[model samples]
Target chain A: MSDHKILQYPKSPYLKTSYYEDTAIQAFDTPFRKKCLVIGLLFWVCFPFVASSYVVHIANLSAIAAIGAMSLNLLIGNTGLLSLGHAGFMGAGAFTTAIMTVQFGLPIWIVIPASGIVGALLGLIAGLPSFQLKGIYLGLSTLAIHHIIKYGCSEYQYYGGFGYGIVLEAPSLGPLLLAGKTVWFFVLWISAFATALLIANLLRSKPGRAWSAIRDRDIAAEVSGIDIGFYKILAFVVSSSLISMQGSLYAYYTAVVSVEEYSFGLTVSYLAMIIVGGLGSVLGSFLGALLITALPYALIILAGLVDLSFAVKEHFSVIQTGVFGMVVILFLLLEPLGLVEIWRRVRCYFELWPFSYKPLTIIKR
Target chain B: MLLASIVVLAGIYALLGSGFVIIYKASRILNFAHAEIVMLAGYLAVSLAVAIPFSAASLLAVLCFCFVLGMSIYAILIRPLAGYSVLSAIILTVAVGVLLNAVGVFVWRGEMEVIPFGWRTYFSLPGNIRLSSIEFATLGIVTLFYACMGLFYRFTKIGQQMRATAENPLLAAQRGISIYRISGIAWGIGFAAAGLAAFLLGINYAISLQIGNIAVAAFVVALIGGLDSLLGTIPAAFIIAATEQLTITYANPRLGDAIPFIIMLMVLMFKPWGLLGTKEELDRV
Candidate 1:
């Protein structure tokens, strides 16, 4: 039965593995998979060139969101460590960018990595408590970290005399002024693509396997000689650093760094992205980001179609939040495996075609 | 005066934390929506107080509504989440919190609204400290609530059943006790306690959407007292309230919001099970 299923698809060069060399180990193993990658890349490349500035802006936001979501997925989904301080780390990166560019006039090259380092240090501090705390306790500690970061950011804003927030000029690379939505769409999406590649590669490596082991059962993993503490802390550091870098990019993209923007609500939205997209999957992170980022606009369109009252339209933010909450709840309750599972099922249906049901062998009585 | 403030704040936290502790004791799930419940109760109390002529009647109405709300929340959201991971239940609570907050803002506009439970009177103490009538009332109510809870658990058949379920759900079910109903009652009592505290808080200070943040501080209180131990909530609340007061007085006022969390982190690091909680609880999670 399984053999029949395997023969349904065209034979691919990378389908079989040799003794020393694994062809199936590559990211795009199948020809169809390679084709999907090319098409996706083409679409991403063409998006900003063809779309309106508003649409491009939304895409750029999704790109930044994708980076954060992927980083969070690395922690929550892969490493089995829940973090509520994602926005705190993102805020750290944003503040780092704000101070570095606006105050010291630092180059973008130095600023981005500086933000990551800051996040890494914060991650270390946050991860230190994870040795003793697990499950809900760890999540609570992260929530504390988030509140502390928010408090610190506000105090820093006060001391700097930037009552509102610090603003930055458009970044420059020699003659290239990285300003408009179109430029940002490329910069952000490319960064997101780079992050996705990095994550994909990491997941296939030893550390990734160790992470999965720890996530599944820490005690069993520890008994097997895996350094659970080191890997857990490493997960925090890597994930936080990636998210922090994305935060720096976001600061640049928005041209402002305000403490108000990085709220617990923002963290919840990123969490929604990872969970809704498909936890532990690279492509799911991006898809979730795009969907969540566009959700509010979609709600607005729906509201217009429904001919909602002007007063109802005024409360669009409320409706958006309610819808977001409902979506997260529905996803948690009905589709715990998330959109990726649904996608897989759909793909399987098409691949199987007429024989959608499981294949059966002939039985002679 | 500082001590008086600590006492009052401790009373407030104890009331809030007891509800948190009760729900955790019965269900083995942390109710993140308790904060929303607090906010909603405050709003509901304010609206009810306005609609009803008598203040006491309004309070009763609000408490009854919150009790039913808690039971329905358990039935609709939590009961369905039983088969899922504990994390799912926690996240579902968060989602519920968000939904409640949105609905609240939509109805109440997120603005601060004071509960018009009449004018306050200040009472002078021997040490040149003066406290409001509401503070005294809050303290009295908190004491009464805990006392009632203790009595109820010791004597009432339903409370005994709840205690049995909390101790061992399978055994309780084998004994023909409805664990679901017991859990619902726990939620109801928990919500009612938080609601009463919220109403008292609204009477003293204006209640806004931001007031829900108090639930976080209350969580720290609950943790310090131990998650499942009701007796620990009082001292935990007292400790947290004093620390918060001292920190605000001595350190930067901005640290006031972060102090409870910092303490929470410390408690989490040094004692994952909480100060008064059972050691086995740490391993269970």
Candidate 2:
């Protein structure tokens, strides 16, 4: 077992909690969990009502990003495939939605499914390289593929009379035109919530179990009669399709689909979401998406509240990115389990009350 | 003449490509921050040049600084996570790259060309071949530096330890090799090499956020050569550079950036480990 270390997940020093399955050892399956979930849903449901239009816009973005981060988390956190091209998948979905709705005059319902198919097909193309590539090699191959996709889209936009960007004519269902920030907020939140639930259930099911097995040890997973190739492709397919679906919705929400929007920065933000939120947990992805999506606006608001130097204001965007990078690096080095673990420890500490103590088993395990 | 120009670009790539190959060979992590380190080196050298008022000495100072800086990063950030997931290390480097880019933007702003070394643009050689002296100097320096590196890796005691550690760190540790020191050395050499490439590139043209994209090109080179095979990177660098040159010359200049990646995709599909990369070492991940 010691010799087969690659097959085992690296036990973090701080948190030894398993990412997917909740083991009985923790005693976390309780009324408290249900209570928290209920509260969270209520918070999200009431968010648009209490919040300003700008806040609703941010919520809509976060919800869209949550769907993306969840899809990426499935690949990176659950299946252990590292991709630098998450933005590309999202962009593919967005572009597909744009072209379908604008050119073919398709309804939103029809466009979404078509985008999902295109995204899945593109995912298959991306997955093609993964058959041979592993770890860093796979990551780079995906980066190259991302660049190609980016180049293709830009080229298409340039020649196809949509050089600036393809703007979707506001989506509609017969009489009901999907318009306004609040309406889009509800629409995005529903899909994001649905996807989160689906993934939470799926990860505990057969294919998710297969993915976890493959991630832990592909060789062993194969030895154990898991269809490793099938699961890997399935993970990519599921991840890409959902990402595309989010992009399709985003096309309407943002009302703009352009290559510029889906830059490397977009990829990094999605990565930041997954890493910050916690890798494997659906709840983590959702939380991560919200935190990151809201962060820049919060920064801007903070900047306004506290008067900044003229010099600092000149390079504000660069400073923001630098701060963002520092935050991510700090998290990786200090709190690799991310926000979920932080939340868990706080809850556990409160539950333990005045006698907050550590068991020696965690250190020695 | 076009072939000569391709060779010149290849020569520069050989040096740039080494940035990826060196760290990858030892630690098995692709240092994505390398391009920024290259850009950083250029800016550092420029600032030093301004401060010291001596070009040659400042350049050396910048290179040495780059060497120590790389070693420090490995010791502080990378070593702790060595035995853990490769994915974490990879993303860590991405963060490192982003931070470095932010620093670069803050220091130099968006786009600033290198104050080119005198002798300016192109110099016409005999036989109707045009040679840019700065480019030729870069080619000469990079080739010579790599030649020394090749010899050092082949003949030196530390090099032997590096190779042994790369083969299997646990076994190397069992054999009393300081995996930490060897990896630090790998990073030091890697950064120093990248610094040299950056300096040469700055002399030839502009250094900006765009030059960071060259790291992707270098990644393509490293991939083709086999990530771990330093010697393999030599010809692979030239071939990739030449391919890029040919594409730019014959096809669209925009397409030039993508040709190596298209080649990489095809290679990964057929032969994933790369030209001279060790096969069995792959499954360890």
**Candidate No. with top lDDT:** 1
> Model 1, stretches more than 4 Å misplaced?
A1-27, A359-365
Give each model's clash number: 0, 0
Span of ten consecutive residues with least summed lDDT in model 1 chain A: A356-365
Residue pairs clashing, model 1: none
Q: Lowest lDDT 10-mer window, candidate 1 chain B?
A: B276-285
Candidates, DockQ: 0.57, 0.46
Q: What lDDT, from 0 to 1, does candidate 1 have?
A: 0.87
Candidate of highest DockQ = 1
Q: Give the alpha-carbon lDDT of every model.
A: 0.87, 0.83
Tens-digit lDDT string for candidate 1 (A49-132): 899898888888999999999999999889888898899999999999998898899989899999999999999998988787
Instruction: Give the per-residue lDDT digits (tens) of candidate 2, residues B39-105.
Output: 8888876667667766678778878998999999999888877666887788788888888889988
| Chain B TM, every candidate | 0.97, 0.93
Clashes of 2: 0
